[model samples]
Target: MRNATIKDVAKHSGVSLKTVSRVINREPSVRTETRERVERSIAALHYQPDPSARSLRSTHSYAIGLVYDNPNAHYVISMQEGVLAACRERGFGLQIHPCDSSAEGLAEEIIRVSRSARLAGLVLAPPMSEQPALIACLKAADIPLVRILAASEDPADGSTCVYVNDRRAAYAVTEHLIQLGHTRIAFLWGDPHHGSSSERFMGYADALKAYGVPLNRKLVLSGQYSFDDGFRRARKLLAVKEAPTAIFGSNDEIAAGVLAAARSTGLDVPWDLSIAGFEDNPFSKQAWPALTTARQSTSEIGQHAALRLMDLLRQNRDGHTDSSVANESFVPELVVRGSTAPPRSASPRAEAPAGDTDSID
Candidate 1:
C-alpha cells in the first residue's frame, strides 16, 4: 500500500498545504475547528509527516542533536535511548554526535555542528555538559539546549540543566558497606577529570566521616573507568600487608574488576572481604555473586533532558513564554545485591605487597 503524505492529508481535508503544515506542527494560530477537521483527515488518510523532508523544506529542522563524550559504551547507549525516546514523542528526529570534549575551539565546533545539522536544538551529556566555559560560550551564541551534568545541586544560577546527584548515590553505597560492619573500606576512583568521579568520591568520604571511620589515604586508589584498571588496582590493594576490609569501586565496571581480583587471590567475598560498586550495569548484576550497587537511570535522565529541550524549542518558536533554562535534579536509587556483607571477625591479610600501596601519596 502507498504511504500517506502531508499532501494527501491536505487534499483530503480540503485545506491548503500551508494550513496542513501549521496543523501538523501544532501552531497556536490554528483554530480548534480547523485543527479538528485537519486531524480527522490526517487520521482517515493515515498520514504521517516526514520530519526529514519537512526539515529540508524549512529553516527550522525537525531533528535535534545529542552530544556526548564518554568512554563507557553502555552509558552512551542508555543516554542515546533516552534522548531518542523523547524525540519520537514530539514527532522529531535525532542525530547522535560523539566528540572529544578536550578539543580546542570546542564551543565553536558545537555551534557549527548545530548550524550545519540545522538542528532545532541540542541535548548535551557529560563531560561536555559539565564544562562551564563551553556552556557559557554556547549560551552566548543563543543555541537552545538542555544539559545533563553530575552535580549534587544546581551548578549554576539562572541556567537550565539536568543534574544527577552522583554524590548522594555514592554516599548511599558507602553507607551500605559501613552498616555491614566494614570500617576498613577501600575507595577506588575512576578518571579524575570527570566531575562524577569526584562527586562519587565525596559521597564515599562523607559516609566514612559520618560513621566515625577514620580515613586511610593508603586505602584510596586512582584509575580509569574500566575493568582492567579496576582489576589492576584491586590486585595492588589486596597485596598490601593490611588491606581494606571492604572495597568500594566508584563504578560497576571497577567493582566487577575488584570481584575478579578477589577470587583470583583466593579471597572469599562477603566473608573475608566485602566488595561493592556504583552504577548497576547489567554485567555487574549478572556476576557470579550479583553486585551490590547504586542504580543510575542514565536513560531516564537523558530522556528528561531531551524532553526539556523540546519544550524550550517550542517556547522559543512560539514566543509565548520565557525560554530561560530550567534547573532540574535527579538522584539514583540504591539496590543491595549479593556482593556485600559484614566483615570477618579477624583480619586475614593478603600476601605482602610486591608493589607497595602503603602510602597513596
Candidate 2:
C-alpha cells in the first residue's frame, strides 16, 4: 500500500497546505483548535512529512550529513542507525557520506558536498574527526560539525564531539587479565591511524606498569584491524619460546581471529591461553567460549553526536549561544566471559585442561 503523505493529512483535515506545514513545523501562527485538528488528521492518515519537500520549501535545509571512513561494517551500521534515529526524532534528513579521509583535497570535497546538499550540519567519525585540516575547512565555510573521538579522558576543546574512552576500557581489560595472574600478556595493534588503537595501547601499557609487570616489547605486535592479521600474529606469538598466557586484540574481529588460530592448532582456550577483545561486537559473544571484552555502545555514541550537531545548528540559527552542550564522554564497560581465566601456570595442576578445541572450519 502507498504510504500517506503530507498532502493527504491537509486534505483530510480540510486545511491549507501552508497551515499543515506550519503545524508540522510547530510554528505558533496556527490556532490551537486548527493545530489539534491537523494533528488528529495526521494521526488518522498516518501522514509522514517528506524531508526533501520540506527542505525545498524552506530557506534553511533540514538535512544532516554523516561522514565516515571506517572499515568495520558493524561499527558503521551501528553509527548510521544512531544518527538516523536522531534525525527522525528531530524531523531532519540524513545523508551518509563515506569518503576516504586520506584523499587529496578531502576537506574541499566534503565542504562542496555539504553545501550542494544543503545539509544543516555534519557528524564526523574518525579519522575524519581527527583531521584538523578538515575541521578548519568546515569552520571556514561556516559549517556546523560534531565529532566522535577516542581518548583516555575527555578532550573537550570547546567543540561539540562524543568521546569514547578506549584507554580506560583497555586498562580495565588488562587489569582483569592481571588480576587473573597473567604476567606475559600480548597486545595486538589495530590501525595506528585510528586514535582508538593508540589509546587502547596506552591503557594496556598503563595497567602493566601499575601492576609491576615489565613491558615486553617482544610481546607487542603491530597490525591492521582484521581477522587475517590476528591469525598471522597469533601463529607467530604461539611459535615463540615463551608464549604469552593472555592475548588482547584491539577489537573483536582480531580476537575472533586469534580464537580461530588457537582452535586450528588444537590449543585449549583460557587453559592454554586466554583471549580478550574490545568493542564487544557480536563475534565476541558468538565465538565458542564467548570472548571476554569491553563494551562500548556505538549506537548511543553516534546518536548523541548527531543530536548535538542538530542542537548546534539550532544555536547558530537562533543567535543564542550556550556553552553547556560541550564535549560528552563515555567509557566502555568491561565484560568478563568464558574466553578468559587464570592461566594454567597459575594453577597447581601441571597439565592444561581441554577447552574449546572445535576447529574453525
For model 2, the superposed segments whose C-alpha errors exceed 4 Å read 1-45, 321-324, 347-361
TM-score of each: 0.86, 0.86
lDDT of 2 at 231: 93
lDDT of 1 at 183: 76
Q: What TM value does model 2 have?
A: 0.86
Number of clashes recorded per candidate: 2, 0
lDDT of candidate 1 at residue 239, scale 0 to 100:
95
Clashing pairs in 2: none
lDDT of 2: 0.87
In candidate 1, which residue ranges exceed 4 Å CA deviation? 7-48, 346-361
Q: Report model 1's TM-score to 2 decimal places.
A: 0.86
